[model samples]
Target chain A: MGKPPPISNRVRLHRMLAGDMTQAELGEAVGVTRHTIIAIEQGRYSPSLETAFRIARLFDVGVEDVFGWEEQP
Target chain B: MYQDLSFREKSAWAMGALALIITLFYLADVQPISWRTGEAPPVDRHFIKIAIATIVGSIIIQSVLAARNPKEAEAPADERERLALARAGNHAGFILAFGSVAALLHYLVHANGDLLFHGILISLLVSTIAESALQIFYFRRGG
Candidate 1:
């Protein structure tokens, strides 16, 4: 398996703040399956770099706002 | 460790088990005793019966299992699953090719066509087993 990038809680919290948008709709907008969206939110899978940008664009947020650097300490 | 196995994993397990049983059935029932009186001779008619039984039985069993989850069975492989299968198949092919070459060399020394055929066939069997085992391992290891 390919090495996965660090996790981000931003996507989960953003989805929740957007009136709890369903994972399926986000997946549709992001051009991936609902399962993939779920995986991303749960940190089991990280999206490709391009896909991550697509998701941020759809949400009208900066990429950094949608994803945070994992805690260093 | 990956805690849960996908549908493909379950299918691999079943297929592997079925393949093994079929191999044993071929060896035990289809293998003929030497017909030469008092002196041992080469076993009779190995290819024809094995070919028929293995082809027919595999088709039937795989069809039935696939029927149970037609969608999952028919689905194009996902990225991770594709990679796993390709790697496994690549590794398994080497094992089969090496074994077959070794067997052929042995047969060359002995000048035994029957032995060569059996050896090549057995290498095919081992390859199948190895591929399935590798699939199971990859599935568990999160690929």
Candidate 2:
């Protein structure tokens, strides 16, 4: 398995704010599978730029709001 | 884990299992004859049987899976899934190349064509199984 990306996301939180949207619903809205959404939410995988833009647009947030770099301390 | 397995992941598992079972059956059929003769046996009924079985089995299994999840079946691989597959395939390719090279070197020393053939064949099967297993692992690890 590959290392997890050094990124964090508020996708789950955004989903909750967006009418408690389910992962599958968000995935369909953003043209990815639910498993991909789950991986993004869990920080196990980083989204492509296109997917990141899609998620931000869906949640009406900037990419920075949806995702943040996790600096190693 | 099984319940939460995605359709693609399930397909990987099924294909891996099928590859293993078929390879084992092929070996069981051919190895004994090769051992009894202590010579390189030509391809015969077992080869034909395995070839037909693999193709037919894959079609049947894929049909059943597609029937169960037509939407996912039609879905293209996502970015992460594609990455995982590529990585798995890359490793499998390395294994195949290394095994083939080793088999050629062994043939140089022993000049036993039968051993070389069996070695290369088994390496191909192992490479396939390794690719599938690695895909399953990657899928579970969140690719």
Worst 10 residues of 2 chain B by lDDT: B38-47
lDDT of each: 0.69, 0.87
lDDT string for model 1 (A1-73, tens) is 4444466747877788778888877876776655456667766555667878988887788898887768634
Candidate 2 local lDDT, B1-143, one digit each (tens): 76577788888888889889989998888878878887646476776787798899899989999999999899999888898899899999999999999999999999988778878877888898899999988877776
* TM-score of candidate 1 relative to the true fold: 0.66
lDDT of 1 by residue, B1-143 (tens): 22244557766776677667766765664344423332222254455666776688678767876787586567666554666678888988998999899889988798777667767787887788788888877654444
List the pairs of residues colliding in candidate 2. none
CAPRI band for model 1: incorrect
Cα error, residue B128 of model 2, in Å, equals 0.8
* Candidate 1 chain B weakest ten by summed lDDT: B33-42
Q: What does the lDDT come to for candidate 1?
A: 0.69
Q: How close to the true structure is residue A24 of candidate 2, measured as C-alpha lDDT?
A: 96
- Please list the residue runs of candidate 2 whose C-alpha ends up more than 4 Å from where it truly belongs after superposition: A1-3
- DockQ of model 1, rounded to 2 decimals: 0.17
| Weakest 10 consecutive residues of candidate 1 chain A by summed lDDT | A1-10
